[model samples]
Target: MQGDYQVISTLLPLENPDHLEARGIHVVRTDVTKDVSVKELKDFLQKFTGGRLDILINNAGICYTMPATDTEIPNVEKMFAVNVFGPMRVVRFLHLMLIEAKGVVVNIGSIGGICPFVYGSSYNASKAALHHYGNTLRVEMRPFGVRVVNVISGEVSTNILKSDHGRSLPQGKWSSTADPAPMGHTDTRAESVFYPLNEEFQKHVHRTPNAITPNQYAEGVVKEIVKRAPAAWFWFGASSTSIRMVDVFLPRTTWDWLFGRMFNLRKLADGLPSQIKL
Candidate 1:
C-alpha cells in the first residue's frame, strides 16, 4: 500500500488542493485539535470511501526547542492540543471507519518522549503524552479488532524544523560526533556560536554527522504498518538506538547528568530569555 500524507490544516498551506489530486493522491485537510474540523473530515471520508477506511494514521505532530525556563504556557498548550489531543480526536472521530475495516491506527511519536532531551521539554512532554495515549488506545481498540501502533522516531530531515522553529540552528555550533562520541566530548565546526543556550539542544542535534532522510524513514514505517500482525511499537532513523541504549544501560540520575552535560542544561537554564516564541 502507498503511504498517505496527512496535512494539518493550520500549519500546511493548501494553496491548490487539486494539485495532489492530479497525481492520484487525495489531500483531505484535517485539523485534529478542532472537533468541528474532525467532524467535517469524517463527513468527507464517509462520502469518499463509503464509510470504510483500512488505516487511520494519526501522524500530525509539532515540535518546539526551547528551555522550559522560557517556554510560554500558551506554547506548551498548543503543542499538547496538537500532539496529544489531536490523536485522541482523530481516532475517536474515525472509529466508525476504522471498525468497519478493522483498520490500524498509527501514532507517530518521538524518542524525546521515551528518553527526554534537554531544552525541548515541552515538545518532549507532548510526545510522551501521545505515547501513553497509544498504549491505552491499543487495549481499548483491540476489542474492535483495530490495532494501535506507536511509531517512536529518531532524527530525520523534515520540514518541522522550519515550520515549528523560528530560527535554524547555525550549521555547526558545538559539534557532536559522527562516530557516537560519549558525553563530555567537545568538538567545533564552521558557523558555530555559543551563549543564549535556548537553541543549544537543537544546535547539538542538527550538527550531528548524519540523520536518516524522511524518504527512507517513511519506507520503513509504512512496511511495518502493513504487516499482517503488526508490532505495537516501532523505532526508526538516527539517534533512536542511542536513546534506547542509554535508557537500558544507565540509571535515572546518570541519564539526567549525561543529558545535562551533553546539552549544557545548567549553563543555559540560568540564561533563559523572558519568553521565546517557538
Candidate 2:
C-alpha cells in the first residue's frame, strides 16, 4: 500500500492534527503562494519520506469575494499564484517521486471555478485555470502511470467565508460611509443590496443544506485513490452535483444570465448594491 501521502495547505487547521493522526497520515505545511516556501517544503517532504512520495493533494487555496471592477490587480496575481501555479509547481517538482511510485495527483478546485460569481472573479478564474491544467496534466501523465484527479467541490463548511481574504460588508474604508449608495438608487444600493444577495446566493447554491466537513472530503479522496481505477474528476458535497449539471447542460448565454442573477449583477448595474466589493 502506498500509505505515504502529502497534504499541502496554507493554514494548519486545528482539526487536521487529530484527523491526520487517526488515519496515519503525514502532514506538511506549505505556503503555496511562495516559490521559495514551496521548494523548502518539497525538500522537507523528500527528506521526511525518504524520497518515496505517493499521493499528492493540491488542496491549498485562498478564496476572496471582490467584484471584478474593484478587485485589486495584485489580488488576481496572488490568487493565481496559490490556486493555479502553486499546484503546477508541486506537480512539476514532485514528478520524479510520483513517477517512481506511479502515484496519484489530486488537484482540489471549486464550484466557482466552473461557475462564475459576481464578486469572485479572482478566486473563480484561478480555479478555472486549475481545472483546465489538471485535465491537461492527466492526459500528459498517462504513460507515467501517474493519475491526476481534479476534485471540484461545491459549498462546504470551511474557513473560506470567515477568512480575512473574504470580502466583508462592513470592515474596510468603504464600509464607514453613511450611505455608500452611488446615486439616485434607493432600492438598488450597492452596500445594502449586495450583502443580502451574497448571503442568499450562498444559501441556494450549496448542494447540501449542511456544510461538508474537511474530514468528509478527505475520506472521499482516500476512497478514490484506493480504487483500482480512479476517476479523472470527482465532484463531492451537495452543491457540487448541481453545479456540475449546470456546467454540462447550460449554454454560455444561459450561464451568463444565471450567473448574473446569482451574483445580483443586474441590480448592481442598476445602481443597487449588487456586488460586495472586497
Candidate 3:
C-alpha cells in the first residue's frame, strides 16, 4: 500500500490521523459498531474506486483480560461488536464490490480463538466465532471468486498488550485499535485481572517468549494475499505452530495443564485443576 496502492484506513474518531495521512494513506473515521459506518465505507469505496475493490481487510479488533465469571456483560458485548460484528458489517456490505474485482477478504484472527484459555473467554469466544464465520464466508463466496483468508495469527509484539492490559502503552498514535479501557494496569500482580485464572495467565504472558514483531507478521500476511490461490487458513509467528498443534491433537485439559504450569495455578490446586477445564 505504501508505493503501489492507495490505502484507505479506518480508525476511531479520537485516534489521530495526521501521521497516517503523512504516509499518504487516506484515513477514514469509523466506529464498526455503528450501522451507518458500513454505508459510509461503501460510499467512500464507490466514489474512490468506481465500485470496484481489490481487497477488504477486517482488522478492527479489541481484547480485554478478564474471566467470564468476573467480566461485565457489556464489555463482552463490546468485544463481540468489534471482533465479530465490525468485520461482518464490512464484508456484508462490500461483498459486491469484492466480487466485481475478484477480491480477497483477509480476517486477522488469533490463536487464542482456537486454543482454549481459562481466563480469556470473552476475547477467545469472539475470535472463535470469527474464525468460524470466515470459514463459512469462504464456502459461501467461492462461486463469486472472492477469497476469504483467515489469518490465525500468533501473538505478535503489537499494542495488543496495552489494549488488553494497559501497561507501557506508547504515547501519541501508535496503534490502530483503540485501548479498550486504559489498560486496567494489567500486570503480574494478582489483582491485575478479576478472575484468579486470568490473573495467573496475565502474569505468565508478561514473561512468555517467542512473540514476533508486527512488521514480520504483516510481511507474512502480504505474502499470503498475493498468492494466486491462497489457503483458506494461514498461520505464522513464533509458537503459533505449537499452539495450533495443541489445539488440534491435545485434549481440552492439556491446554489447562499448560495454563497451570505456566502460571503456577497447579500448585494452588495440588495437580492441574479440573475445575478450569473447558
Give the candidate number with the greatest lDDT.
3
Models 1 onward score TM values of: 0.77, 0.74, 0.81
What overall lDDT, based on C-alpha atoms, would model 2 receive against the true structure?
Answer: 0.69
Question: Per-residue lDDT for 1-278 in model 3, tens only?
Answer: 57566788998889999978998999888888888977897898899989998888899998866555345567688889999999998887889999999999999998888876656778889999999999999999999999999989888877665665532212232222334333333322222122334444556446444689878988899888878898889987777799888878988789777876765664444422343333
* Model 1 per-residue lDDT tens digits across residues 183-276: 2333223222334563655555455336788779978988998897888988877889888888788786776888878777667555433342
Ten-residue region with minimum lDDT total, candidate 3 = 167-176
Off by over 4 Å in 2: 1-25, 164-210, 272-278
Task: Give the per-residue lDDT digits (tens) of candidate 2, residues 1-278.
Answer: 12443543334434455655455555565666667777877798678766766778888787666556445566577768778888988787778888887888889888888876656778888888999999999999999989989888866777666554324442222242344333322322224334445555444333233667877877777898667678888888758887788779877577788877655667555444323342
The TM-score ranking, best first, is: 3, 1, 2
The true-versus-predicted C-alpha distance at residue 56 of model 3, in Å, is 0.7
Candidate 1, poorest ten consecutive residues by summed lDDT:
175-184
Residue pairs that clash (backbone atoms under 3 angstroms), model 2: 188-272, 189-272, 189-273, 190-273, 194-273, 207-238, 207-239, 208-238
lDDT (Cα atoms) of all candidates against the true structure: 0.72, 0.69, 0.76
Model 3 stretches astray by more than 4 angstroms:
1-3, 166-209, 270-278
What residue runs in model 1 are displaced by over 4 Å at the alpha carbon? 1-23, 164-209, 266-278
Q: Which candidate is the best by TM-score?
A: 3
